[model samples]
Target: MKKNVFYVLMLFFVFTACNREDMQNNPGNIEVVQKDPLTAKEINEKINETIKTKGRFSWKESSDHFIWSTIFQGNKIASIGFGSSFDRNLDSNNKAIEAEILKVIEQYEGKTERILLSSDQYLNQIDVAIEKQETVIALRKMKNIRYLEPADYRYFENEQKLGKSSSGSSGCGFESTALSASDYTTVTPNAKAPWSFTKHNIINAWSYSSGAGVTIGVIDSGVSPEQTLLGSSFNNGLSSGRTISKNGVYVDSIWPWSTGYDGPNDQCGHGTSMASAAAAPRNNQGQPVGVAYNSNLVTYRAASNVVLDGYHEQNGVKIAFTELGNNNNVKIISMSMGHIFSVGKIEDGVKYAYSKGKLIFCAGGTSTSFTNFVGVIFPAWMSETQAITGVKENTSNQKCDVCHSGAEIDFTYQMERASGNSIPVLSYYNGQTDYVGGSSVATASTAGIAALVWSKNPTWTRDQVLNKMRQSATYYPTPNSDYGYGNINVLQAVQ
Candidate 1:
């Protein structure tokens, strides 16, 4: 009878050990209590609530489980940020983290096959499929994992599908307008200088430096091929000895695994105006001239629209920043595109470029159809970039009707005209001009002015150039609560 009892005890212990191993390996079988997925309305409401309570919303501050349930609706894919935040030298360490994450994923999903959708070569970020909620819980507990956000959550697209009104600030246009004589002054070679040029003293600044030696990298929609001045005729008339290159990093697909890249061409009209506002060639075609007419140009088609509302758009921006950061010739990086809240990969990309000593400029928020309650907006709100917004003519304190302003605004541009016009830029098509307004043109024009300053003081560090600009601005030594240093006097900045 004692021997029989010993055999039964051994069987019981063996069965318990087997059950424990199975539970550890297969977390899906451990009876997880799942919550209902949040609706679009609920998600937006939560975001507003958070913003009201915290004064701002950041994915980094939110819990990993909430991010999965709300933004992603328990979507299978998640963006993983590992290693130290903004650590440029964590490449090898990141690889190790990637391995560990994959191991954890395998333990939960019970599959060893490749699950990583995409991994950034430079930034310590990866996109992977997490089948079980337990996996998210476990990953959050890991010391090396910094953040886990939905990799493919597209807020604007989802909103549209749900029959919401289109965001008023899509920043997509193709129409070209005629230049009114009252809006411009005739310059040499029959070129037209925008009236705002005189308001900011950019014409006077030209005598000092036309951004001849500096290269400005535009991270926006690509320049139009039909606009010859930005292309084969880039060196026409007085704008000589400068090169313009076009690149495309935007993927046309929503799938994270899509490898096809849309070519370097501006599908949206916003990019063309931005490029024209910054560095359109000074030519004899009776066209509107740019701020840095003689500056070298490098434009990237990084997104479908100025509103970064989709997965591919965000990914494209990340790729553009990294590539521009690696480029030795790029001195200033300008992006008039942004999101209402911070994106982890984009933050990483901006930090990478900033670390490479590239002077960056981003647009302050512009009023959108959905909401305008946001302040400076992501990337611009970050300290690494100089945020610019549009202001009414001759008034630094008053912002344009559609432009957003806050304490984060670094500078204001005289973009809005008394006649209800904005800055005149070369149209997407050749031999045409268009009016672009809000903070988009403001940011680009400011970038052009920076190019001029950097060109004049070629040996100056980024800080030196920035300091000079601040000192030369309308409000120096002290900043306004709404606008930082206020309007920049281009001539004074270049000098």
Candidate 2:
């Protein structure tokens, strides 16, 4: 009987120990242990659980704006916004526009900070926590204030927008072949150029000339500053002859800050990829190299996040374009974003930049239905911009998928992505994860080719450079929309 009692005691102790461990690590109430946001599977399970319990299960966390991307540190700003006006001609009287905007925002303004441009137009960095759309609607009620959109941009997190992919057959890949690196203050590791060099004949184009006196502008997420190959040439990338605009306006060669962080920061990782496609440098191994190795990379943070909401807030974008266009040093500007939003300031920005003798490359977008259903997404739709489409051809001789191609597209460029956990492009990124494959990637690649040709023919006008690219592009079919002008041939364009 004593032995039996002791055995019972031992069982009790073991039970207590197990229960204690469970309490410390994973409690019986599993819901209490969940810290991270729910994935699709988890979300479905949660909904079903709530339904099964007939509203017994209460939601754990709640938020108005979904934290789709990397949650930044520090106090989350209550609001963000950009500058706009009911009067389209407000740009003509930029100062008046600022004064007028200031008056309107006064009602809802929490912290007001605006950067007044030489055009007298000011982009409101001032933030308000209230409903900006509703406020804008109310503001429009006041005469002379037709437009008052929020300047702060938000994109659905990469995971939200483009669901994480492991199956190479599915998902998007941003071909950042030569996405330009950040303004190099310093670099050490030799660049190991990737196979993409010879893949697109960029190697042969190198034989002719690499972008030397050129500056390329990348408008996207943001960029990373400490690139080994890109750091080789920093302040030296500027075109001394045309550093400042003819209007006497000076835009810095490198505008690296994105969102709130000062200096180079790419949260989404797309910006660095896009920049590398524009102008990564040749390294010892050249594992990751840009098309315009010799050119400088100037990153423009137009959006705080990936949500471009049809560019209702065009102020920041306008400033970026204004800087790139006015600065003669920036000969090419590559934009890899597209949306269903109608023609607006984006079209104007492209027009303005092109007028300033800068070649512009824009992404065509991957929505297959978009190509057949509505039409090409703008600002790629804009005539002034060279809308680049994507083709998935492994080799020059391979027949590729139409993918993002459309008749409106100016040139077709080969894009790459890997199945599972591989990033195929020669690229650089700040975030832990990366992605490739899109019209944007193709656009950057094409921009690199243009940079190559332009580097060889430094004196060539933007028009001449564009024509050479179109004429030299490989052919898919004359009347086919599958491949526009055809894949860009760097060798042929240079030859």
Give the winner by TM-score. Answer: 1
TM-scores for all candidates: the values are: 0.92, 0.58
Give the TM-score comparing model 2 with the true structure, all chains together. Answer: 0.58
Off by over 4 Å in 2: 1-196, 232-262, 310-315, 367-375, 394-403, 417-435, 476-479
Give the alpha carbon lDDT tens digit for every residue of 397-451 in model 1. Answer: 8999889899899999999988999988888888778999999999999999999
* Candidate 1: pairs in clash: 168-369
Against the reference, the lDDT scores of all candidates come to: 0.85, 0.50
User: Given candidate 2, what's the lDDT at residue 322?
Assistant: 62
Q: Report the Cα lDDT for candidate 1.
A: 0.85
Candidate 2 structure quality by residue, lDDT tens digits, 11-79: 999988877533312222123222333343443344335434542222212221222111111112122
Each prediction's number of clashing residue pairs = 1, 36
lDDT of 2: 0.50
